[model samples]
Each structure stands twice: as C-alpha cells, then as structure tokens.
Target: MIKIDELREGFGSFWGSVSEGWDRLRHTAAGALTRFKPGEQTALPDRGQIDDPLHFPAQSWSMLGGDVFEDEQRLVVRIEAPGMEKDNFAIEISGDTLVVRGEKRFEGETTEGRWRVLQCAYGAFQRTVPLPAAVRGDEAKASYRNGVLKIDLPKVQPGKPTSVNIKVD
Candidate 1:
C-alpha cells in the first residue's frame, strides 16, 4: 500500500512578517549610510511634503528612482530626472553598482520682486542603483527622453558546463 504525506501549512511563513519588518528597517539604515559615503557630498532632505510622499526616501524608490522592472533578458530602469539636458547627465556602472549623476541649476536673472515660491530641487544629485544581478556591464545602454532617463541592461549569459569522462591520464 502507498501512503500520502500531509503538507506543512505554515512552517517558514510564520516568520515572514517579522523578517519583512526587519528587512525594511535594515534597508532604511543602509540607504541613509550609503547616501553619505566619503567624498560623496550629499544633502539630507528635510521632512518631505506631506502631499508628496514620493519625494521622501522612505517611499521615494529603491535607489533606482521611479519604476524599475526586469525580464528574462533585460532590466529596465526609468528614472525621473527632470530639468536636465543630455550633456548634464551621466550613467556609469562599476561592477554591480550603477550611478546616475547630474546637476540642475536655474539660471537667468529676473527683476520683478522677491521670490515667493521655489520648490524644485537644484544642484548636484546622484542616484545609485544596485543591479539585481551581475549584468553585461559593457552592453548597457541609456537614453533620455521627455525628462526621463531609461536604462536597458542586458543580462549576462551563463555558460553551460560540460563533464568529460577520463579513462587514464
């Protein structure tokens, strides 16, 4: 006679909530620390606007800005880099880390009155994205259109291994 085994309902999932909470806490700390590395001058943003949670680091993004998606062959990164020109931006990938850097400066003088409202961010900014996997660093391509920077990262193909039988060598 053959016997069937009952499934374990929630063995590992029991700790899922706790583990997820712990990861969020750790990710926040890591993001803060990494944003202040040596020689990397950065500004700590004040409490974000209540109306714009997307401007806050806690809810902004995963260093990749906006939406980042992946597929079997490519990783697509869409960054919100508004108020920038092609020459004012740069995309560089070193090892597993991809860095997007640029500066935005509002030029031109106007003599009307004192400033009443100025909210858009200006000055040097850098966003670093850690790739989901080691990509083909050489074949990465980027393009800027309609105030968005899109990066296409091709996945590196893993070579198959072959087993050879040896008689006597």
Candidate 2:
C-alpha cells in the first residue's frame, strides 16, 4: 500500500514537469508562436475529413518574424507575412509602437483525398513593433512585395533654438 503523502508528491512532480516543458517551448520558439483565430470558412482546412499526424490542436500558432532599422533620417520596418494580399494589411502608428494587422486567406487546392498534414497557419493576426525615436506618422510610406511588408517612417526633426537678448535695468 502507498501512503497518501507519497501519492501527492508524485502528482506534484508530474505537473511540475509539464509546466517546465511549456516554459522551455515558449522561450525557445518565441517567434514561431503567432496566436491565431478561426477566420472565414476557407481560412482552414475541412476538419471533418482531415487528419493531423502531429496531433496539433485545432487552434495553431504561426510565425510572423519582423525587423526594424533606423538611420539619421528615418526608420524602416520589415515583416514577413506570406499568403496575403496587399489590400488586406492595415498599418497604424499607436504612440511609439507600429501596429500591423492582416488576415491570411486560404486558397484550397484541387485535390480529392483528405488532408493528412496541415502545418500552415491561417486566420487573422496582429503584430506590433516598438519604435525607438519619434517619427512623422503622416509621412509614413509602405509597400508589399514577394510576401514581405516594408514601411518607411521619417523621423521628426527638432526645431531650431532661438537666442534672446537681455537689457540691464
């Protein structure tokens, strides 16, 4: 017969292991974890006849990596978000952060059998990057090509200092 305290200890150890693994995965694959939600009907494969070999949950995370470069004149931001049209992306500057939101639509292939593995992530997602210096939001320029979104934001120029003359009383 096993003691009650020993059983409790065993369960605690099991939970601790699970929590530790999750923490490791989260840190190791930070860029590969883009939270997503179900979008239109065509956004995801037909779950009724599809099979997941990796046993991934219905709600899967995607990877949307980005980079920021700054110079004396302007700041440039580049984000990788494939499988989306140019009109689908919406860029905005909120305070000192640059927010990018878009939806990746799914274009179903002409196949007969059920899908065996679905690794690509679909649906609506938003990514934000913090800006180092103040920028001219109204003068921002953006372009998308070959699955990359690029934005150029001009930095705000400082005003000139004015000198004042004092008279002795």
Error of 1 at 148 (Å): 0.9
Give the top-scoring candidate (lDDT).
2
Worst 10 residues of 2 by lDDT: 155-164
Maximum-TM-score candidate: 2
Write candidate 1's Cα lDDT for 4-49 as tens digits: 3322335456578779988997775453222312122323233431
Task: Give lDDT tens digits, candidate 2, residues 131-157.
Answer: 877889999999999999999989896
Superposition error at 71 for model 1 (Å):
0.8
How accurate locally is residue 38 in candidate 1, as Cα lDDT from 0 to 100? 16
**Global lDDT of each model?**
0.60, 0.80
Clashes of 2: 0
TM-score of each: 0.55, 0.71
